[model samples]
Target: MIRVERVGPLATIQDLGRPGWFDSGVGIAGAADRSSLRLANRLVGNPEGAAGIEALLGGLELLAQRHLTVAVTGAPAPASVDGRPVGAASVLEIEEGQRLRLGLATTGLRSYVAVRGGIDVAPVLGSRSRDTLSGIGPEPLRAGDVLPVGPPPRTHPIVDVAPVAAPAGDLLTVRVVPGPRADWFADAGALYRGEWTVSSDTDRIGARLDRRSGPTLDRRGAGELPTEGMALGSIQVPPSGQPVVFLADHPITGGYPVVAVVVDADVDLVAQARPGQPMRFRPC
Candidate 1:
């Protein structure tokens, strides 16, 4: 069992996310950096879909009430177990009554911490993820919230840490393909290839891209379109012409025209990007 002695800015349980529940108004609120979460889970012998804590901007702390193994991954936050420094992505023996604290992240925006047997949060709509926009499942973890730890299976698995680095340069290379509504805009490929700056108005919902010229589209003959289902990597262009890349916690539906969609492999890179960072799209 783990006790939350101190919860930082934002921390919540997340797994692979409950896909196909969007029709029921449930958003997939899984880890923004899915690779890191998977790495942590593998290190601790947890299932790939096991729910773990997703710490935004780091600063997550907890006290272990039982002897268990834990692993941290994602952001480059200096971590410590019982006041001693520990490396991220490596398994550490967390003994009972030991305190663990994570400092601020320097490179990425979010981090993942996986524990043996995973966090035992009651799943909502088949997911342990916290959806702030839809108010589904548990709320953001706060101080005094006792996180339940479940018993693990008899067998244990070993996984070596695969070092992942932060994306270099202010300009991010995001791979994208023609979207469903690509024909809605002129020069879809060219528009995406152009450089766009990440605006301060970015979050789990979406990252707003600042473009110099508005997207040119012909909607004169088209009727008022109904709101359509949105995907994780969708890039929508509203009347403002600026593109907004949907993230893990984005709404299920939107009415804006999707210019291009980022490739699944590169979405995590966008999710980890800080504000004011410049990004350029490339055709897949």
Candidate 2:
């Protein structure tokens, strides 16, 4: 078991997410960076889908109540145990009463911390993920939270450190395929023009990309379109012409037109893009 000493900008217990509920209006809300969460779990010998803590912009502190193996991945946030510095993406032995702390993220937005055993929170809808859009799963972690750790898996840790490229600090380019409503835009190619800045309003539900410079995407046909089902990576363009890349917690339906859809793998990259980061969309 471990206790939350302090939580920074945001911290939530997450697994892969509760999928297959779209028809029921539930989005697959889980770790913003699925790859990072999985990597952290793998380092600690836990299943890739094991529930762990997702720290937004770092600043999460935990006190281990027992001996445990742990790993920190994503965002490469500065990690320390009992005032001593530690390395990210590496396994560490935490003794009872040891304090594990993560400082502010220097590059990416979300950081993942995985314990030997997964977080044993009661599941909601067969998942331990917290959907920020819908009040589902465990609530955001707070100080004084006593997190129960599940029994460790039969498998044991084999790797010591997993080296992964840190999240990008410069402009990020993502691949996109044409969206269903691409025809609605006067020039769907507008997505490929000019750099898009991640808006401050961006959240787990969607990433609103403010058009730094480019004509607002005007629809060919006037009048509003019917509310259509929206999916992860669905790049919906509002009347303002800015493209909003839907993330894990995106809504099930939207009325705006979707000009282009980001590729599946790149959706993870978009999730890590911090506010005000420059981004470019490449038509695949």
Best by lDDT: 2
Which parts of model 2 are misplaced by more than 4 Å?
none
Per-residue lDDT tens digits for candidate 1, residues 181-211, read 8777656765654577789888777899886
| lDDT per residue as tens, model 2, 1-284 | 99999999889999999988888889889888999999999999999999999999999999999998999999989999999999889999999999999999999999999998899999999899999999999999999999999999999999899888999999999999987898888888777877889999888899998877766667787768899898789999887776789998898899999888889899999999999999999988
Query: What's model 2's TM-score?
Result: 0.97
Which residue pairs in candidate 1 collide? none
Q: What lDDT, from 0 to 1, does candidate 2 have?
A: 0.91
- Evaluate model 1: give its TM-score: 0.91
Per-model CA lDDT versus the true structure: 0.81, 0.91
